[model samples]
Target: MDKLQYDNLYKFLVSLGIVLIVLPVAALVFLFNMEPILISQADYDLLSDFSLQMIATRNKLTSYFISIFPWVAGILTCIGIVVLLIGIFKWVGLQKNLDKKLDAEAAIQTLNLLKMSSAEVAAKIEEEVKETVSIEAPTPPVSSAVNDHSSAMNKYIEIEDLCFNYFTKRYANKYSFERNIRMGKYCYDFIGVSKLNNIDLIVEIKYLKIAAGNSRMIYDVFERVYNSGVNYETIAHRNFKCVVVIVTPKEELPRLENIVETYCKAHRENASRIEIKCMAEESL
Candidate 1:
């Protein structure tokens, strides 16, 4: 497991070993010296009789134990040392892996930030030029078919109230009253659209009762979008796309799957143009 757990286990084993070795040897020493606190009157009488009977014996019970004590102590000490070494080794290995992961994540984040900043700068320059130079610029015509399609897509608004409700309920006890409050809704789904030279996208939140089925549909949508010549980077930067996310009880998966599948197929063309994904309740 973790370094803390390993270190704690090692410490516990070392403590146990010390107690086992020291307590037994200390007891033997007290018994040999006939320490009053070490033995009761009954025990002393029994030992006296045993000593008399064993007068011809070359070894005493305490003496035998004392001779073996060093070996026992040495074995326990070695075991404790080995356990500690193993814990240290595991801790070092985990730390190295964690560091590598963190460094890679940091590099990725920096690259993404730079890309976004560059796009923003380009957009700003385009806006400035349009405002400064307007010499009878040809009026851009809007297509009626495109307008109708955009309106139809906009009509299918995804409700995100359920997701907000789930999170608020999930974290109620952990947050304060004010902190626990949720605004209108939390959205995490996006809709995709394709134009001649540019793509339009809309982001909305939708709730799905069947999370696994929804996840599969999301994968299908991503595949369709990718195949439709839409790159992930364009989708990420486009503002016309909307995400539809749905939240429902996890147990409703079986009943909700059919309904979700039906909806996905009915809007297959529109859905194909978009990418979808699910975040589990636990993740939220």
Candidate 2:
């Protein structure tokens, strides 16, 4: 049966049982203590029996009950007590089961809420990624007088955004990411913290100029990211990891792998903690 119905039924039964027990006990008490109020001794005697012998026998029987009133009360009271205990046991069992069912239902609701929140976050991140990708460079370059690296910085900034969002999809609701993280001397492109998984992600980005075929770019990019990761790792506790994303032309993929392999050979132990992601320039 439904828990509420079960509870109401047990409560009603307990209350009814109490009333039944109380009324009988009250009637017995009044019959003994307030006998005059119920029916006076003079009236009882005047209501004549058929014979004097019969009247004396009835009086003897009545006196016997009066003498054993305590024993009679004790026996009836024990029966009432047993009924009360049975009702109490039934209520307790019903309530305990109800509590467990309620707890289970609450847990299910919490899990569903987490799933909904994860879906919303995933949706928002996807929408922002599309917007970032669709944004084309301005016609005029904003101004001709800007710093030499200013254009370079502007060009690769969306690439940075793309990389951050890429991992955000993989991590989903498990981690929360922040961009332009400035802590401990150097500014990091992104930092993702996941308390649930006990993990921290340090993301660094390098947009390679594959058009110039700068083979030295591989060495420079790896060195820079490795240094930053080492510095971050100094203060980082356990479960610290790094991802270095390189945006390059499709032609330079082999060169990128060679550089990473060389680095890994020299530092095999730390290699497991670091990961690399290479992307084609056109894709971004």
Candidate 3:
């Protein structure tokens, strides 16, 4: 039977046992009080010596009850005690089983809560990065190209190599160039992971005079780097850093730095997670 049924049955048995034990004692008391004398005092004078001592001191009704009721009382008391012990033992076992079940359920719930917290942390980081890029650094249009396509491509490659070498030296064995970091529907450039502090790194090299819209490319690079870093952090539970190296002439470095400084000032909280550097083309 179920726990409830067993509990109810045990309670009833306990009550019945108590009644059985008590009823016989009460009946014996009543019988002794009502039937006090077993024989008449006048009859004692005529009786022989052996016959005078044959009868009980109490009444015959009490004597008859004493002969049969002692066995009945003993049997009832034994049954009552056994039933009470069984009920108590079973109830305690059921209670312990219930406690273990509750503990298991609570453990499962705690694990689910931790999973949800992990997802929220990832989502919050992604949202903050998106906001910083979209508001502080708006995408620019494809203006007239300042340099021819062939020369610009060669210059871009040289600068990218220089930046790679710089980071390789700085981060030692932890640096990677053109590593596949998957963002939404795209893979980004130069993703590195630092084991020392659990830092996710994204390095981008920007050459402004390219035939393509260099200003527009800057926003795209920023967004992709941040998203990729956030994705990595979510999975690995690491800190993320985005580094953008602008490759322009020495004369133009001041203007680009001013632009990056303006962006940083606009979004100070998000800016702390990013680094923007102006590198001269001559250095490449």
Candidate 4:
């Protein structure tokens, strides 16, 4: 039965037991008092001995009741124990149901992840953009290519040899790679002291074209890196550094440096904290 129905049934049983136990005591009391009124005067003399013996017998019965009172208490205690065991069993069943629900949710998430395609992922990205636009916080704009490059760079930064040398030179024992770590989600780009010490870093290289849009893209890259560092600082309590390196054609180095300086200042970060290095055209 349901919990409420079972509770009501138990309550009815308890009430019935109380009534049954009290009725006999009340009857015995009444019977003892009625003997005096019911007995005749002529029979009183001869019946005196019998009445005395009857009274003694009643006393013995009362003694028996007193002795059995503990048994009634024991029965009630047993009922309480049974109720508690039933409640525990129900709780265990409920927990099992909850576990099944969680397992189903996990399975659904895995299936959704497997079914996701590039187009669908892009649509999800656009939806995320719209949602961010609706929020009060400033939304950082990132291009699909930049996003992909950033993600890849983050993966490269977690390389054992790279992360070890990167953090050991600065903070020494302050950071340990013994523990598993991740990028963006756990740590930011590989440039902030907080993130580098606490988590691994990502180094991204953006190849720029000689166009106005490319110049703007370069500026955005710097912004993305700075934002990543800011994000790490805001979330991570440990000390680390994430470095962003930009590789451009030899001719574009001067302009890139200027843009990097401007972007760093705009983001309220230091230029020295980031490495804007130029590499050979083929090297990039």
Model 2 C-alpha lDDT per residue in residues 1-284, reported as the tens digit of each score: 12223337666556655654675578687776854324577787777656557767877877897788767677666676676677778889888867655544443343233332334434433433333232322233445525533445455656777777787887866566666644455556676665344356777776665424443544455566667766755654424577877776678666666666776787676566678776776775
> Which pairs of residues collide in candidate 2?
none
Model 2, runs deviating above 4 Å? 1-150, 211-238
Candidate 2 Cα lDDT to native: 0.60
Residues 185-254, candidate 1: write the lDDT tens digits. 2212222223221233333344343344345544453444343233333434333343444434556544
Best by lDDT: 2
**Per-residue error at 207 for model 3, in Å?**
1.5
Model 4 C-alpha lDDT per residue in residues 1-284, reported as the tens digit of each score: 12232344444444444544555556557656664445666766667677878877987877787688667656655665565555556656665666655544443343233344445434433443333233312344555546744543343333323434544575543322221223344322223222122333434434342322344555555556656656544544333344555544567667667776666677555555555654434342
Ranking by lDDT: 2, 3, 4, 1
lDDT per residue, candidate 3, 227-249, as tens digits?
Answer: 76676556445566888777677
| TM-score list, all predictions | 0.27, 0.43, 0.42, 0.29
Q: What is the lDDT of residue 96 in candidate 3?
A: 66
Give candidate 4 regions above 4 Å deviation: 1-202, 233-237, 261-273
Candidate 4: worst-modelled 10 consecutive residues by lDDT: 188-197
Best model number under TM-score: 2
Measured over all alpha carbons after superposition, the RMSD of each candidate to the real structure, in angstroms, is: 15.6, 14.0, 18.9, 16.6
Model 4 accuracy (lDDT, Cα) = 0.47
Please provide the root mean square deviation of candidate 1 (C-alpha atoms, Å).
15.6
**Candidate 3 local distance difference test against the native:** 0.58
Residue 131, model 3: Cα distance from true site in angstroms? 21
Candidate 1 segments whose C-alpha is farther than 4 A from its true place:
1-70, 89-93, 118-221, 224-260, 263-284
Error of 3 at 265 (Å): 1.6
